[model samples]
Target chain A: MELLLVRHALALPPEGEGEEADHLRPLAPRGVRRFRKVVRGLRGLGVKLDLIVTSPKRRALETAEILADLLEGESWVSSHLAAPPSEALLAELPKEGRLAVVGHEPYLSELLVWLLLGDFLGQSALGSLEDRFPLKKGGVAWLEGEPRPGGMVLRAFFPPKVFRI
Target chain B: MRDARAWVEHLRAHLPVALSGKDPEGVHQVRVAGRRLRVYLDLLGWRVLRDDLRRLVQGAGRVRDLEVVLAGPWALPQGFRRFLEGELHLAREALSPLLASPWTAALLGALEVLPPLEEGQALRALGRLEAKAKRRWKALSLNPSPEALHAYRRALRRVRYAKEFLGLPSRREKILQEALGNLQDLEVLLGLLEAFLSQGADREVLALKEALLVEREKNMAEALERLGLA
Candidate 1:
């Protein structure tokens, strides 16, 4: 089974205005444009997904839903792919068919590490000084190989900046 | 033949004996008793028994899978665990809503029909099961073929499924659940068995068999106790 892990596009800053409103923050305009470009790139690479799964979080779900419409498959909202998706969730993914998951950072990066190397490396392994991994909004990682955890071989890592240029 | 009282009494009396018996005939008998009781429960509108039977069936289903794991030639890779769990999650999600449907109610309702214990019918079935179980035991004791193991597992599953359909008593669920746990351990043994078969008889295989035998005895004891045979 092949898996394509896509990070959701950039969102409005959490610091703006009220707490509840921050949770509802939509993607930034540039983030939207960047996501479209990334989607195009995915299409360019001929990634045909059998299923599109996204975090329940709004931004991630929206991004996945859009992609699901583009791809010939059903889209599901799963907390399993959400930020800090549990080991149980990781254990639950199907082994057959091509799948795509769109969600936020930290979790996405952790998932990547967990898939590539059977262990979750937290934030330190992302090669960034900040407390978080910078999988810029709309970044995409193309992984290939068996669906088993730690069985994935990284094929490509496409950052939003790369798509921007 | 359709008498509910007679059906229940016969099932109650025969089930324990069949379960405790050493041969496949006994196992088959126990299974028959379970099925008869389930049919009777449905006929008599025994809701509680029906529910109990459902739980028993679920537990038995797990045991059945375990049996395949134990007796089958192939062992699911560790990665497959994650895949299975994921599939289970998806299945549960899909099945949740269907649980409330009338079809489910009707299926459960079908468990209450109590067929007549007419002349040795139950006994014949039980006898067949007991004989099968004995044959399996002998095969395992002597040759330990994969096919024998698979048959043994299937017999255990039949027992479990029957219990679930009957919805016997509260303790039945706990006992069945424990038996299911034993089945899982047996599945691990099966995996080892595959390893042994594929790798050929060696010191490691013998060592694994010894360890597995110990575990199997413990699990079997637990299962027998749970089934109220002990």
Candidate 2:
């Protein structure tokens, strides 16, 4: 399986008076414009996704929608992506093809290390790993292997800038 | 100045107990405090620490949802029970550090010092909340998916809380929220059951899911009636 871990694009700060207002924070107009170019660049690099699983948060959902639009992939929202990294997230993977998972920071970074090392790193070590392999907003890391911890090899890492270029 | 300060104190008092994970009420209270404060911030138009509070609430919510599931009167399969326990543990593991971090204290400090809204601003806040609730209720009445219903419930809650803050009549909002809260609980349970089924289907889990779905439908009807949308 080929997996792409993509962080959500830039979003407006939360506004208004409810939890939905917080959850519904959409991508800023600039984020949409920039990510469109990033998606084009991914297409230019021959990236294709069979499915895109995204966090239910609006920003990440918007990011996945963009990928599905450009890459012709099916998109679904999963709360697991919005929460902590867990075996359940791994278990939820559809075992057969290329997929893109779009979600938030720190969680995505933690997940990246978990996948790379086959297990969660200690908090101290994980911080160092995050520093070493920071996934900026709208960045993506591509890996190839079975969808299990330590089973995949990092194939490429692209910041949105790389795609815009 | 609208219970924001009280909620800050509420959160502070509950922090240690919640971090201990000894009493579920601690986390529950913390979640409540965080939510109340968020609404106050929105109404007062205070921008500081809103995102921080949101992250805290979401983290606590993951733990609280599992706690509710585990405490419910259901005959969960042993495997499913184990899975819930594992999920709850992971959620707590994720939430504990955030609650313990200095940033949380900073968030609390900032919330404590938020300037009070003016007299007219209080009425404006109430007006904004009323508009939001009406809009959400209208949308849900049109298409009451489980997700839409859940979103509607949150809007109702905001109205209820805001009204209370402003010392206005809020009993109607509270009644509606109670009807919706039961439905939301079943929705969370059904979601977990479905996710467990994804791993591999067990006959018992399937049966439990069917039972829950039936209950959810009945509750949905009651909720719609309560909101006069039936």
Candidate 3:
């Protein structure tokens, strides 16, 4: 099964210093406007997902909504996507076709890295994040092959900079 | 040591050095520090904060690997040296935004709210990690294959980080880590030399490649001895 790790579009800062404040924060107007480009980029790629799951956070929900609408699919809220995902959680996923996960980072990046590299050894060794296929706001990473540890490979990774939206 | 705050602070303090990624140790420290933070954050169920730092980690990781190769005892050509320097410069430049991300503040707040870790829980976690490391070390000691040795190095590195997280001494793990790293460095250098040779390097470069392969054999032998395989 293929999975796409999609970071939510850029959102405004938390309204307060609390975690709840961060959780409740939604996408900014600019974020919504810019994410259209990401949509276009995905459209350009022309790959279809069988399902879409997203974090429960407001911004992630909104991104999921956008993706669901754009990709012509239904979206579900999975609490697991809000944090680091477990292999069991992933194994239980519908294995029919491709799936897209809309969430925040380091959860998304950590999950992707864990999927790519068996153990996290050297993430910050040295270099620009760009060449690294970093998932900024509205960024998307394409992955496939087995979901087991170090069994997956990255096919495509598009940052927000890659899209006009 | 009692809670996740220490790990968070460790990452917060070292992030800038990782961002400044020109220094090899600094880059290596930052990557290790960030993963340590991720480890705790994962335990606390707050991985959202890890994304921004992961970018810095990625950039620093690539450059540090290159730096390690360039730092080898063998002399490299001026052209390759310039290429490596440019690569390092670009890598350091990529991590600049991570320093500015306000989301980092959110991570600190998240750390504060995580339930204070109990001593027992910390010890248990460290024990599990140590056991895994020992198992991996045993395998490497038996096989001494490059792949097995590399896996052992990774396991030891994780144990070292986890040991530090548990506020335990990681001196032995650190020593093993250095020996394993030296062997890994040789592998990385030999990889580049092989790539150059594949591209049809000149006789001088070919000679350098041969010398590096000989050095690789020595590094591997030392690494095996350190791991008690010899």
User: What would the per-residue lDDT of candidate 2 be over residues B1-230, giving only the tens digit for each residue?
Assistant: 35566777889999999999999999999999989887886677543345567888999999999999999988889999999999999999999998887456545644554546565887787788888878887888899778889988898898888877777889988887886787888889999998899999899999999899898888888878776778
lDDT digits (tens) for residues A30-85 of candidate 2: 98898888789888878888877777676776687677754454554466787778
True contacts kept of 2: 0.00
Candidate 2 wrongly placed segments (more than 4 Å):
A1-165, B1-3
For every prediction, compared with the true complex, DockQ reads: 0.01, 0.03, 0.04
Give per-residue CA lDDT, model 3, range B1-230, as digits (tens).
64666656676677666666545676677676667765554333333434544654676677777778777676888766666677666666665664544334444443444445466666676677678878888887777788788888877787777667666799998988886786787777767666556755667777777787787778888878766688
State the TM-score, rounded to 2 decimals, of chain A in model 3: 0.86
List ranges where model 3 is wrong by over 4 Å.
Answer: A1-165, B17-26, B41-56, B97-114, B119-121, B195-200
Better of 1 and 2 by DockQ: 2
Better of 1 and 3 by DockQ: 3
DockQ of 1: 0.01
Every candidate's lDDT: 0.54, 0.81, 0.69
Candidate 2 clash figure, as a count? 0
Per TM-score, what order, best first?
2, 3, 1
Output the chain A TM-score of model 2: 0.91
Models 1 onward score TM values of: 0.39, 0.59, 0.54
**Model 1 lDDT at residue B186:** 64
- Candidate 2 matches the true fold with a TM-score of 0.59
